[model samples]
Target: MASSMLNGAEGLKLTGMRSPHGLGSMNSTLHGKPLSKMGLTPFNLRKDAKFVAPKCSLSSSRPASQPRFIQHKKEAFWFYRFLSIVYDHVINPGHWTEDMRDEALKPADLYSPRLKVVDVGGGTGFTTLGIVKHVDPKNVTIIDQSPHQLAKARQKEPLKECTIMEGDAEDLPFPTDSFDRYISAGSIEYWPEPQRGIREAYRVLRQGGVACVIGPVYPTFWLSRFFADMWMLFPKEEEYIEWFKNAGFKDVQLKRIGPKWYRGVRRHGLIMGCSVTGVKRQPGDSPLQLGPKAEDVERPVNPFSFLLRFVLGSIAATYFVLVPIYMWIKDQITPKGMPI
Candidate 1:
């Protein structure tokens, strides 16, 4: 653990990030949410002086740096824990719908009769549960980095064929072309090196294989260290498609699973995202490389969440903390454009 920390520190140092450890800590607390503006103290306000002035509009977006994947000896554990805690509180059986399961199952190419499926980021078998119900788990393996979270998932062992493997997403410990169908729900977004992981997925998938990655994107695009850290994961739609296709995924179709009966939990952070589906191209086939896809159609908030945010925003505004509290409440919910 100490060595890993040293490596993390060294990696931070290499990037020339100021107080990488501190930034990591702040990023950890922010989770997938952006920073709350109202929560800023006099000190934080002073720190943000460069942009807080009248001349700063915060209107124009700044250029985002392309990220190199972070290789950590330990697999990231926060996302798994986040799901565990979320399920603990809000198990809206309604939230887990057949449509989601059906849509989730759509990417299965059924490479073989045994159906060798690999489920990445199968926390508590949420995505795994949907897949097992739809196909043969006997040929399935759930790969995750956290033992504690995986163990919690293993307690039930709903299906005997569902095996769990502990490993990293960026550097998968598997042979190439080993899987027929690769489905990752709420997984790839967590990849510190998403491109590397995408390429790895391409390397492992058999020809004519289907690779569906449900990478996350926030509805809110901002400059908070909190937002930058995660937003870095959920790039624009084409950016995601290009990442996989560039890695050799053909017929790479990045679809937005929003609009129709979208999940309210998805737009937690004022930003909306889409579910991206890409397929590994057969050799010699020119992959689907197209111009930028349109953003998801406008979506209204769920009744419950909308009411809550309205109430909170109103209350916070009265207290002169509207921006901070509103952002906090927004971040507290799931991301918009409906991610899980």
Candidate 2:
């Protein structure tokens, strides 16, 4: 029964693609309502909803020059346990505001209301909310490794119909050619293997589909670079484009983004600096080859070391939190049009 239902959904998707008006005008209704309202499932997992191991070996090598405390999956899982509580309120206002979110998502081309979209590492559904503004909530899926963050997303009234699941970004469970659009925002810095995650993004997207990844660019200022290195992976802009190109994406483009108060100053590097978009021209897995899983999740962690790293990483993170406030104050006092 599940298989038949799945087949039916695929038929709808294919039919929607042929329509002139896109998926929105397709006859995907059941009893005068969308199929999702009647529990018509969309996800077609590779291993019966279990983690599907990547085809290529995941390299454990660190992409950034220095090691970051929260780059590991286990550490990040714990970090968001506390941050999720005040994430939308505290982080959103300073770093990822509604305006910035909207502007960054523009290149992803969320044009069809019935387009199937996946928000990988969708923590707290902040970016997913931006997606739902253009597409139907039922057509969206939010996946993140952090249960605490997913809990916040589940509580959002606007996201009631969206499918929310706990999943890894580096090893997505979905089959290839699964989604029309893929988006990940402010989540790449936490990835231990960012290239693997970006590869997964390319794998899941259907031919002609778009993948938009929004993440922090490495800081140039000496002080900001110190804290950024300690806190998490702040990749240089060129790395983002290279990752997409290696994954077999075509026409890859990146748009620079930052807080309004920052006044175009990239010396310190905004928490969310660029939005990179790429089109999937093929119909299978990413072309980028990798080797062996980086960090072993099953490896036992020492209690003392974990405590020390977590504490120091939290302190480094505090510096970034205060940076926006400091810049905002400067922007207010530095005259109307001048940069802060």
Task: Give the count of colliding residue pairs in each prediction.
Answer: 15, 2
- Per-residue lDDT tens digits of candidate 1, residues 98-172? 444444355454434476788876656667776776567788888877665677668756655687888666666
User: Model 2, 1-340: lDDT tens per residue?
Assistant: 0111111123211110221112122134423754343222222222222212122111232355345998887888899999999999888888898878986887788998999999999999999999999999999999999999999999989999999999999899999999999999988998888888889999999998989999887775668877887889888655776688788887665556677777656566577877878888889988888887687788999988888888889898889888888888987889865644
Clash list (residue pairs), candidate 2: 58-292, 60-294
For model 1, what is the C-alpha lDDT against the true structure?
Answer: 0.46
Task: Output the TM-score of candidate 2.
Answer: 0.81
The parts of candidate 1 lying over 4 Å away from their true place are 1-75, 78-98, 109-113, 220-232, 258-272, 282-340
Q: Which prediction has the highest lDDT against the true structure? A: 2
Best by TM-score: 2
Worst 10 residues of 2 by lDDT: 12-21
- lDDT, model 2, position 31: 33
Root-mean-square deviation of every model = 18.2, 14.3
